[model samples]
Target: MAGGAAHRRPLAGALAALAALSACSLFVGVGALSPRMLLDEPDAVALMLASRLPRTLAVLLAGSGLAIAGLVMQTMARNRFVEPSTAGTMQGAALGILLVTILAPGASILAKAAAATATALATTSLFLAMIHRLPPTQPFLVPLFGLVYGGVIGAGVTYVAWQADLLQLIEIWLNGEFSGVLRGRYELLWLTAACVALTWWVADRLTIMSLGREASVGLGVDYAGMLRVGLVIVSGVSALTVVVVGAIPFVGLVVPALVSRLAGDNLRSTIPLVGLCGAMLVLVCDMAGRLLRYPYEIPVGTVLGVVGALAFLAILHAGPRHG
Candidate 1:
């Protein structure tokens, strides 16, 4: 109770900062719009509505979705270091997207998202089964196998992309960048928002399932059923995020972990906060990418990739201390 009370002010401050940063994000793009004219000028209104609004929405949805997915992945794996990336889920989704591009060239965005989600869920289930079969004492083996598995799939996709003569397009698909987002193209992210809502709805069940399969079953929960539901939701969210903002690696891993640190591991209470933190991180990184180079823009994905890698190392160094 005392801890939750202490977090109130800090959490409020974080929310305000995120909201302010997201507002600024709407005006910081490569356009002539000014904050003052956001509502008054027709041209500014048009640009804000047609471009910035949807982009902003996409950022929120995708950020929240990935954060929730990370939260679930870490909880289920019982390892703070684990996430969709470490579990081979995102790699599987990427491979699915690549396969779609090859098999059904010029497929609709919805089709691609569906393929990615299905592949991610399937791969995560396989990884989980493999890990579950291992002795409980050998916990590290699961993540190690997952890491190597994801690497192999990633390498395979890269090779295929190189051979397809569509390497550039495929590369663009994985490189997290929100710059290319526009009204029609970004509607796909709404699916991510929907997934976030669903996560909240199932938050309590997920929390119980995270307690270990035996505990969950002991508590009258359908352990396998709950796990599948959680993973499917996570995969769908992650895949849509990848489709929208490319791969903002570690947002899911970092944001939810940070939230759990400050707010405790109550998934029911932490969902929105994780989302806000994720949005703030991406918004900050995106602005930094734009401002650092001025005329020469660096993609938000690249900046995040570099920063995420450093953060991942820091988390590794910090070890279970942070957890």
Candidate 2:
């Protein structure tokens, strides 16, 4: 009972902090809709509804969803260094988006996202299949192979985009930013959030899944089914984020890895923390992007790229720890 209470306290505090950040996010744009103006000014209400609220929500959903995907990838692969970006998921999604642009220039965002999701799933499945063959004793090999594989897939995407005259268009999906997010535009991210939430229901099964297939079956877990579910969740989340706000790289890798250090890998207990921590980290990065250049803004992906790289190096310096 005491242990549960202790855990709840940190979650509570994190939630409170997120609430504060969300409020701050509401007022951070160049248009400057102050809290005082919101009480009486009609334009403030319009700005809040049309722009601020949606951007905040998109940021929250993307951050949390990416983190959850990363955790699921780590669990399934039993590797700390793998996530959507490192595992070919994002590259696959980008290819899908490019092909859709070439084949269906007038496609809706939903169609593009659908295509991206399908390709992302295929690529992630391919990566997993390749990783599964490597000796489990050599943990470093999984992420290394994943990196090489993702690079090959990414190269294919780049070459095809160049051939099709879609390099500029592809560039938009390559780096994630939320400046254009509006109420109607960013709603699809809710689907990603939903997929992540669903994982909580089967958290125990996933925990057992990390033990590998034969062992998972011995422990009464349906390893193949869970792996499929994880892949779908990871691919869907990655594709949706790419489609909606471009790719928020490394949120998945950075957040889950750090959270596991504190909360350990019991998904039931750590899932909430992982999501909250990810949201917080991303919100901070988004705000920094807005503030660092003042009126001008940087992409959240660019901000996170630098930050994630540093964090990635730090994590590596700390040495690889099993999830």
Candidate 3:
């Protein structure tokens, strides 16, 4: 009972913080939104419904999805640093988007997302294959190789976009801003909500797979099948996020690591907290971006990239002993 109480307190605190930040997100934009206006002004009602609500929802959904993706990657790779960006999934999605823009300029949003998902799956599979070849004693090599792989892919994307004169569109997709997310523009993020639900459903199987292939197979788990499922989930979530809000780096890496620190690695219990913390982090970053320049807005991706980098460094310094 005492241990349970201790666990509940942090979970409760995280949820509370998430709630507060979400509320602030709804009210902190450039628009003049106030309690009084929400009740009295029709334009305010429309604005709140059309822009504020959707932006807030998008942040929450994207944050949760990315964080969960990170957890899934770490589990599959058996490496803490192997999040979407580090694992080349984001670059794969970027490459897919660039390809579609170049090949089918008039492609629908769904088609673009499909292309991105396919590329993300392929890239993630390559990462897994590379990791399999490396000695397990050198865990750091996996992420280092992933970074190089992703960098190469990113460079290719840049070259292609430059040649095609689609650099500006790719820039917007890479920067990951939520300022332009109105209702219709952001509804695709709802797909991430379904992805999160699917993650919850498979949480137990993933936890088993994290014990390594030999151990998982010994336990009668379908190791190969589960790996494919995990990759699909990670690819779908990463691709959808890139499609909807661009790539918000480190949410996946940082949030899951933090949740594991607090709650241990029983993912069934911790995934919810991971999702909540991820949502809170992004909401806080998004709110900070809105307020930083008063009238002008900074992109959430830029803010989180700086903040997440610092946090990532700290996590590295702390080492696994602390975690």
Candidate 4:
């Protein structure tokens, strides 16, 4: 009982911090708007509705969704370092987006998203098939293979973009930013948010699946179907995020690894904390990007890349120690 209370306390604290940061996020952009202006200035309210609110919501949804998706990927692969960005999922989505942009420039956002999601799903499935063939004794090989696989896919995408002269546009998808998120721009992330909830509902089966495929089948958890579900969630979330805000790497890799240290592998309770930390990490980075440059803005993806890269190395150094 006391242990449960202790756990709840940190979650509650994280929730409070996220709420506070979200409020500050609204006031950071170049426009002169604030909570004070909303009472009397119609423009402030319109600006709030049109831009600030949507951006904040996008950050929350994308961050939380990615974190949950990462957790699901880790649970399925039984590898801490494997996630969308490392597993070719994001690269495949980038490929789909590039193809649509080149072949059907007139495609609607939904069509483009569909293509990206399809390719991302395919890539994730292929990665899983490859992982299945590898011996489980060397778990580290999964991540090493994923990194090489994703790099190859990413290189191909870059080459295509260069040949097509879409390299500049593709950069936006490579490094995520929330500046373009307005009222109508980011609603698709809601679907991924719903996916996160579904993950929570099936969290127990996922935890059991983490033990291994044989163990999951022995426990009557329908391992194949659940693996597909997790793949879809991971792919959908990764594709939508790239389509909307671009690829923000290492959220999946770092957040879950850190969360595991604090909470162990019982995803039912830890998922919420993971989601909260993800949201806070992105929000804080976004805010820093705004303040560090004053009038100009750095992409949140750049800030996170710097931070996530350092964290990634730290995780690499410490992983064997933990194991």
- 10 residues in a row with least lDDT, candidate 3: 1-10
Model 4: residues with Cα > 4 Å off, grouped in runs:
1-3, 321-323
| TM-score of each prediction | 0.92, 0.97, 0.96, 0.96
Steric clash pairs (candidate 3): none
Measured by lDDT, the strongest candidate is 2
Q: Taking the tens digit of each residue's C-alpha lDDT, what string does model 1 give over 1-323? A: 12365656766887899888888888876787787896688888889988888887777777777888888888777767778877888888887888898999889888999999999898888877777676656655666787898788778878988888777765676677777888898888888778888888888888888777888888998987888788888799878877666777788888877777777777877777887788788778877887788756788778878887788777666667633
lDDT order of candidates, best first? Answer: 2, 4, 3, 1
- Cα miss at 47, model 2 (Å)? 0.8
lDDT of 4 at 27: 88
List, residue by residue over 1-323, the lDDT tens digit for candidate 4: 12387579889999999999999999889999878999999999999999999999999998888888889988888888787899999999999999999999999988988999999999999999998888777778888899999999999999999999999988999899998999999998898888898898888989999988889999999999999889888999999999999998888888999999877888878988999998898888888888899888899899999998899889888864433
Q: How many backbone clashes does candidate 2 have?
A: 0
